[model samples]
Target: MQGLARGIVVLGVMLAGVQAAHAQPIKSPQDQACRDEARARVFSTPDPQGVGPYVIGRQIYMACMQRASHRASVPHRRAAKRVKRAKRAKHR
Candidate 1:
């Protein structure tokens, strides 16, 4: 009976961990605006390279997207750190 109880507890803890890890990070409004602006800028410009305008536009859009995304995800990163610290404290 004790063994069974221990197994169930372990399973519950594992599921909780999985749920936490799978939770989606919330996107900030600024991130959305940044992406929208990048999209518009890329689409509005003519292909300067001429050989492959889309490729150049795509590169520019992606660079903008990454920078904005990284900035916007700062809160998520901080929350993750807090979670990690809490878990460490719990274990100790």
Candidate 2:
């Protein structure tokens, strides 16, 4: 009876955990490229976590991502920067 009860509890916990487990797919080409670059850089560099010198793959990835993000927002920034002039010739 105790063994059966434990099995039921484990099954219940696993079922509950299914909802929380999820994977986010890469959303853009820039993101995919960044990931590829990071993977390659990390592999080529010495593994600090394993041996010695730290890898700068993460830095490469982040810089690329930030640049891409900034480029994507440029249009919106330009729009926000310009305000339309209002004419009051009628009042004059």
Tens-digit lDDT track for model 1 on 1-92? 99999999999999999999965463766546655665577666677567464465557657877887787667767789899999999999
* Model 1 lDDT at residue 38: 56
**Model 1, residue 85: C-alpha shift (Å):** 20
Q: Per-residue lDDT for 1-92 in model 2, tens only?
A: 99999999999999878755632478889989887877777667666556432237667778889988988877765454443212344345
Report, for all candidates in order, the number of backbone clashes: 0, 0
Cα RMSD of predicted structure 2: 9.4
Q: What is the lDDT of residue 64 in candidate 2?
A: 82
**lDDT of model 2, residue 71:** 84
Local distance difference test, candidate 2: 0.71
The alpha-carbon lDDT assigned to residue 56 of candidate 1 equals: 59
Q: Which ranges in model 2 have alpha carbons more than 4 Å from their true place?
A: 1-24, 43-55, 76-92
Error of 1 at 64 (Å): 1.6
